[model samples]
Target: MIEVKNVSMSFRISQDRIQSIKEYLVALIKGKLKYKDFWALRDVSFSVHPGEVLGIIGHNGAGKSTVLKVISGILKPTSGSVSVHGNIVPMLELGSGFDFDLTGRENIFLNGAILGYSRKFLNEKYDDIVAFSELGEFIEMPIRNYSSGMLMRLAFSIATVVNPEILIVDEILAVGDESFQRKSRQRMMELMSGGTTVLFVSHSLEQIREMCDRVLWLDHGQVKMIGEAQEVCDAYQI
Candidate 1:
């Protein structure tokens, strides 16, 4: 289960765009520095039960992704609280734990380590990870030579191989070709069937309707709606 209660996050952004470090230092010393308070989220609250699938949807700059980051523990909320009751696997970005200089084979271990998997556990699952990625011979090549699609495939494979208790996905499904997207969706289905809690963020309302049991709609950092997937999606679409 996961709960986010009255969570708010704010950042102090420079009001004036300083061109260089020297300019910034001069502004600092001259007491002419200016900042603006930007609130990414405010008083957002929601809950997801174990084995539930919750989809988050919003327009650009609407704080949808920020909510996921807070739940994934990447960003701490400025106020309120978040509680997660299981091991979390967050697929927030491409190549998050990958080393471009390392071969795919090596980065598999590296990525697995970042996910808190033991060496023995990774060794046992290594073949499955490679096979899922379908990099084949390219697995021996440095990741820097791989395309964006290849990086996404590898990242998804590693993140899902161990069946994390809670999976946080943020528009990562939009990567790769149609075929890869289908495969990724099927894998997510399998994980969901196995009782994994899923928190998904996507602009694809159709995908959200198909995959989510519930949906949360955010607008300007506030909870605009939270209810059944179809109801929320239909309302949002209108």
Candidate 2:
């Protein structure tokens, strides 16, 4: 189960960066360049059952990704609370925990370790991960040489290797090709069928409607509506 109550996140963003030492001194003295607080999420509350698939949808800067980040424990909410039960696998960013200097094969073990998986467990899943990623020859090469799509494939393959109890996914499916997206969708369906709780954030409304059991529509960091997939998505489309 996952519960997010009155979750709000605020960030202090610098308005502008001084280009040179002179500019910095002038700005510092004049207070021309300052920071402003931007609230990404505000008073958003929701819950997900053990086997439910919840889809979060909105436009750019709508706080859709903020909700997932809070749930994944990547970003702390400025206010309110987020509680998640069971093991979680978050596919929020591709190449986030990766080392560009390390080979894909080495990073697999490294990533598995980060995820609290034993060497034995990673060993058992190594071949499958490589196969699924379809980066056979390149898996032995440094990750710095990999393309964005290739990186997404590897990340998705590793993140989904284990059937986690809770899965939090952002718009990572947008990076891969059509074939890989289809493959990833199939894997997600398998996980959902296994009764895993899923929190998905995507701009693709069609995909959200097709895969999600329930949908939460967010606008400007606020919960606009939350209900059945069709109804919420229908309203969001407007």
Candidate 3:
């Protein structure tokens, strides 16, 4: 289960754009770095029980992603508390862990290790990951040469090879070509039904309504509504 209570997050961002490192350094030394408090999330609270699929919906910068980051332990709320039970696999910002200098083959181990997969586990699943990625001969090439779709495909394959008790996804189903997208959706459904708690954020209301058991709607960094998927989605559309 995931429990979040009275969560508020604040970031102090520079009011003026510093175009260069030298300018930033000068401003810092002169104590002239103008900053403003930006509240990304305000008193957001919710919970997802095991085997539940909870979808988060909001406009950009409405704190959908921020809430997920807090739950994944990627960011700390400036106030309040978050508790997550069981292992978590976060697919937010897919391919963010890659080394462009390395071959796809090499990064299977490199990126897998970053996700806390044991080397022995990667070794056993390496072939399966390669096949699922459909990279074929390109797996031997440096990742820098890969197209964006190819890169995301590899990342998705590596990340989804093992199912975790909790899955956090942010528009990840849009990763690849149409055929791969269908396959990815099927895989996601399997994971969801396998007793994994899923926290998903997507712009596709149709997809959300279809896959999610419940929806949380945020407007301006606060919970606007939380209810059945169809109910909240209907209100969000109107």
User: Which candidate tops lDDT?
Assistant: 3
* Candidate 3 segments exceeding 4 Å error: 17-33
Off by over 4 Å in 1: 17-25
TM-score of 3: 0.91
lDDT of 3 at 8: 95
Ranking by lDDT: 3, 1, 2
C-alpha lDDT of all candidate models, in order: 0.90, 0.87, 0.92
Error of 2 at 103 (Å): 2.0
lDDT of 2 by residue, 1-238 (tens): 9989999999888778557999888888997878889999989999999999999888899998878878888899999999988989877775567989999999998887887678998999999999999999999999999998898899888888888889888866644899888998788778767888888888898889888999998999999999999999889887
**Residue-level lDDT tens digits of model 1 in 1-238:** 9989999999878878899999999999999899988999999999999999999999999998899889888899999999999999888875677889999999999988888788999999999999999889999999999998898899888888988889888877755689988898888779877888999999999889999999999999999999999999999999
Candidate order (TM-score):
1, 3, 2
lDDT of 3 by residue, 47-143 (tens): 9989999999999999999999999999999999999999888888787779999999999999898888898999999999999999999999999
Candidate 2 backbone collisions, by pair: none
Highest TM-score: give the candidate number.
1
TM-score of each: 0.92, 0.87, 0.91
Model 2 stretches with alpha carbons more than 4 Å out: 17-35, 174-178
Candidate 1, which ten residues in sequence have the lowest lDDT sum? 168-177
Name the lDDT of candidate 1: 0.90
